[model samples]
Target: MRLTELPRTTSFRLALMFLALFGTCSLLLFAFVYWQTVGYMRRDQDEFLQRQLTFYSTLSPADRVQRLREHPRNDPGTRRPSGEFAANGQWLVGNLSVLPAELRQAHQPVDFVLPSAGAPVPFRGYATQLPDGHWLAVSQNVHEPREFEALLLRAMLSAGLLTLLFGLAGAVALGASSMRRIDAITLAIRRIVNGALTERLPVQGGSDDLNRLTREVNGMLDDLERLVHEVKGVCDGIAHDLRTPLTRVLGGLERAQRRASTVEEFRDAAARATEEIAALLKTFNALLRISELEAGARRAGFSDVALAQVLADVVDLYQPLAEEKNLTLQLSGTASPTDITLWGDASLLFDACANLIDNAIKFVPAGGHIEVRLDAEHRAISVTDNGPGIPASERKAVLNRFHRNEPSRSTPGNGLGLSLVAVIAHLHDMKIDITDAAPGCRVSLSWSAR
Candidate 1:
């Protein structure tokens, strides 16, 4: 904004550079015009002087002498001076009282100093022999053209100065505006870097390049805020879930050490303690797997995988488990494996779909209906069950680490099945949607090849 800072901006520097280029071009153009104009004026003067001498030479000596008697200098428009003198360099009968020293030995057009103005002046003249054996001289005035040249020079100089002033003012205004915007962006980013997660850059609602950059930066901030919240939730869940199990294990071990007297009593406590420890390890491993998937490394090994085949395999893997639980498991979709092919990591997709089916079978009541449907035409796979469906408010929450609905708390799970499925779906550029299926829930994962 200050004069000292203006020179440091790119806009100001570019303005100055363009102005210099334009000024140089203007100067060269004026110089050329001046030179050509002067040359033309001098040529016209020489022609006028030669014409006067030729016209006078055609006259008789008496007429020539009579013409010389006229005071030619008295006519301002033609300042042509005429003179005749005995070849003795004496005073002549003309407005030019004396011949310039530089012109004494030559008949060419020349310039001489004016004693009245004390300045050099231009004139073109001719010297010729008269019939009386004397010298005759005539000159054409050149001052008018020279005066015109001076006036042109002054006009151009004033206009150039004005143009320079206006251009500089405009450049300064533009540079200041640009610098102010840049300064604002810098300050906003600094605040964000200082842990102000909710802070956002301002958008002017224009399609300028800087506005687009600001929008992109704001988008990144939004993602950062979401990710920070997710991490915080995961940490809190870890501390809360692991603490109870860990305390129970410690209490069981302590009891065995102090009260157990027989080997059978010690064995029972040890088995219970081992089960709690196994659960802790399982929770840790599931968290690690979700982190790995979200980190986006699994997609690197993606290949063409048929969704129908994955569904069938999931149904097969969980059928026996469903039978043991007395739940009716059914696979109803494309019978052929070649119906719908998806571009993704096959193993990851298999695992994700397996979790979905497993989740459905676990929650469904005895003899309840469980179905895996694959829509080859739409490239969608959904798992539905007649279990206590998740509430609309809790559907989204169930996709987070260790987030369990009230109905799922009694089930033997760490609340990471759907979370892992969400991670895998994201890595494959897929979308996971959960909706109420009448008396139960329907979970569907859909995607395109790209």
Candidate 2:
């Protein structure tokens, strides 16, 4: 990827955010260290000056003079450490030349300047009033803290520079690695879009967030590829199933136009064409309804549905048709009132069951039997028929729209009954299991309430 594109990636943006946060924390740390250093230095100075004043106040005048004599005398013209001054401002017998004008004759120490040999020095001192109209002052030297501050500042600057450089480099390195992974993901997606349904996003070794996302995306791709194939199959069905019926309609119309001598002959051809058109419309409607149900548009009407009631209703609705064909239609199930109900669209569930029962009635030979069972214990419904059963190999194929088995082609159905059942089951989060029922077929749809 281009350098300019790097910044546009999620990793680079997150790195920039990290850098900002790091800078903020660094500034706060620097401020805290500077404040603490200054406080420590001032505290040490205060304690030293207080001790000197306390010692000076304890001494007798004569002994105090001896102690003042011990103050450093090697540097001539330097300020004294201990001294006595008359109230009239004359230096009595200490190291200082005279009393500092700013040193109040009070117990607390105060800061002042003292003239020395070369440059004037900074000092802090305390003065106490004596019993004999004199002031005893004790002083301590205080070098300028700015010189030490300058040294500390230089050290901090060097360390801070190193930290910034290293942190930024690490951030960039991490961002680059993320970008590489993202690029791989993009390449994989591009290949998929180019008809490579078998392609999948690569998962790196660690189970990081990116890898988890890749795995989820790969799973979605699996479904998408299946749906794409299913759609292709549906398209193929449309071409295969609709073409013959549509051709019949067109051929009837052509025959009516060309070969029919009388109006009655033309009317007969037109009547046959109308029948084919109606069949086409039925198939079309069934496909549309399946799509609509699978899309979940009917879910808004959902409510608690009694499974037993739905099965009973399917039997009643198809009982007459079964009687007309000399077939026995029976509904048998056991359920407590509480256990019989499930959450679903009542109308849709009835329609699905009706379709299943209708298919059984149509497929079973005259005098054959069709059975509908509601298993409340398992949250399932099954329809079984005693006729020509579907082979195990064709069970799955028969669920696709317009897929007619070889023996059932002459039956009057658009071949969408079980396909509609599958769509309804899917919308209701149910599964369909098709199996041979000794003499015929049994198709059961089961639901998981939990």
Candidate 3:
């Protein structure tokens, strides 16, 4: 960021705007003070003149003349002076030499300048016509008030200049700070674009608006990085998982073409190939279903669903398989089936619960007890199996697509069952918890009732 670009920044521009507003207000305040001060000084001077005029008016003519003649001697400074003048404009007695032509009205205050030594001195005064047709004027020299006005103006100007300097400095500082943060963010974004997936925006640790925005962007970057890694993992999983089935299908077909002379033998080979193809198709379909669920494509199909009913249905669907494996499958809950309900897609919820029960049947040993438990108050359903439970470390990994536990490698599955369940739970705004069932594993899905 260059100095030339500083003014273009929003922070700098706003600072300048506020500074201008403050300067304007200060100027108005100074003007008002100046006006009031000058008016008060002028009024005070005029009042003094009026008081002098009244004192002279109460005196006899002889005494008035004596006081007027003695005024310059009694007040050697001559800051305030009185004078008597004839109607013809001739100065009679006092410090003043002649009647001011500016004082045309009687008993009215006026401002005029008189030659004092070699300089012209400003005065405020009032003149009154006596019965003898002579003018008596009382005045005060206003050099101090005028000097005070000039001093006040200079002080105001100095203060204004200082304020402007400081304000400009502050604005520049603020603009520079903003520019630095923006530059850091831009650099981070460029790094991310250049494939530094872990790059994040800088945080100043302040709770200011800019810092808050940076934190949010960094959080988004964190999510983006996680998604990128997940996508890479998914692609790898697809390639690895599909290669075996596709190879088996191709190898079986080639074997049947080259060596299977008898129809029965050919039919056997064809059947094996068909099975591999079917398994491939099932895996692909499961992947698609998980994708659809993750994208919330089935949200429009959501309706109020009973948790206990879904658990019972899942247990019923998987009970025969559990029995075939010499396992016991039971549906149990603390509340009535009708009472534990939530808003969700019924089919998706059923499929999710079925997946949990199916996984339990697959993993649990012979004569293992599997229970589908529902909690009405928490709007939750849990499937627990008394078999070798999933390892604590692999619990979260099993939720990812195509993730299979080491011990379950020989099991008949594409490894998408729990992933599908996870997607379904997420789509319904439910939380899935995999916990220890004491003797085995417990997988629970819970939601907040709206």
Candidate 4:
């Protein structure tokens, strides 16, 4: 967030490290090029000096002196000069007036300086001792090559400076970007911690790694918000639904204590209170079962279960209830009962199927028809009944605890049957769909291929 902190950021530090590494490599490469170029130029100068000395060696002394005198006149610039000298270091011919001390080594190349009219000039030359005890020296001035080397060094330095500047700027930009995103995320998290359940992390809308991580965190926030709301709703539902049964139990006992005149009257009041207490216990048990299923505790008892057989058993268990209400109950499938199977807890599946059948029997009119259908290829089972269908708007709500339709409020239930079914379906990795069967309601549970 601040300029002083930029260098401490990981992005900036990593960029600086790479820049340092690149700069080191560039320096090494430049040094190699400088070494090779200087070496090549000096080699070229040495070869030229050796060739000139060899030519003079093949000549007579008198002709060699003549050629040396003629060499300076052929090129008036005196860039290349040849001189004949005595063994005592006396300059005898050519434009050179003083023999350099570098000529002390016979038949070897050396570098030395000579004075010009304006400044001192550098030269590379070879000296050889003639058979007559005289000396032959040939040289070439190297001022331009030295200047070229200086120019190359300056250019490399300029390029390296510019690269360093640009690299630092890029590192700062990346660090600043990262810092801004982190600040936004921190602010959002603080807001959420302060009870802003809807707050979410910021996203830049790019497919970069940071953006992808932000999106995932936001999705998790969404789920957390939903769960918090569900927990609050469950608490409210528990308080409201349990209060009625408890009040009835208290009221029935109090009436018996106050006005019951005989043992029979007292027994009736006790029976009524017991029935309400039993219903309250049933509701609590159903809640615990749902919680257990949702926590995946039933998964340990999982095994291959014939779903068709479960449906048959459910139909048989609920057939007498349907008959007592003058309703028709039937079970049919697209495949053999033995062949339609699933991987789940058998008792849970049976309870879920039984709940669906019981609901159809309870709600359907007298003489109404109900069918339990199974589709093996699609791994689905459904119950269709000619009853007043659940409205589409309340379908999802009915799967929550203590949720009952207005028409079914007078029925004898705590409204946990479908909620239990939903938890069972979830434990088995199945989806429940409530759809209209034209004139009635159809509830289906399906699972994908494992």
Residue-wise C-alpha lDDT for candidate 3, range 176-269, written one tens digit per residue: 9999888889998999999998888989976999899988888998878776776776787777778988888888889889999999999999
Model number with the top TM-score = 3
Highest lDDT, which number?
4
TM per prediction: 0.71, 0.69, 0.87, 0.82
Worst 10 residues of 2 by lDDT: 71-80
Question: Comparing 1 and 2 by lDDT, which wins?
Answer: 1
Q: Which consecutive 10 residues in model 3 have the weakest lDDT in total?
A: 98-107
Query: Where does candidate 3 stray beyond 4 Å?
Result: 54-63, 66-77, 88-90, 93-101, 104-122, 334-337, 437-439
In candidate 1, stretches whose alpha carbon ends up further than 4 angstroms from where it belongs are 1-6, 9-76, 79-163, 207-212, 255-262, 321-343, 360-399, 405-408, 431-450
Question: Residue 342 CA error for candidate 1 (Å)?
Answer: 4.3
Q: Could you arrange the candidates by lDDT from highest to lowest?
A: 4, 3, 1, 2
User: Which residue pairs clash in candidate 2?
Assistant: none
Can you tell me which runs of candidate 4 are displaced by over 4 Å?
25-82, 92-99, 102-122, 207-209, 323-341, 359-373, 381-395, 405-408, 432-444
Q: Cα RMSDs of all predictions?
A: 5.5, 6.1, 3.1, 3.7
What's the number of clashes in each of the models?
0, 0, 0, 0
Clash-forming residue pairs, model 1: none
The TM-score of candidate 1 is 0.71
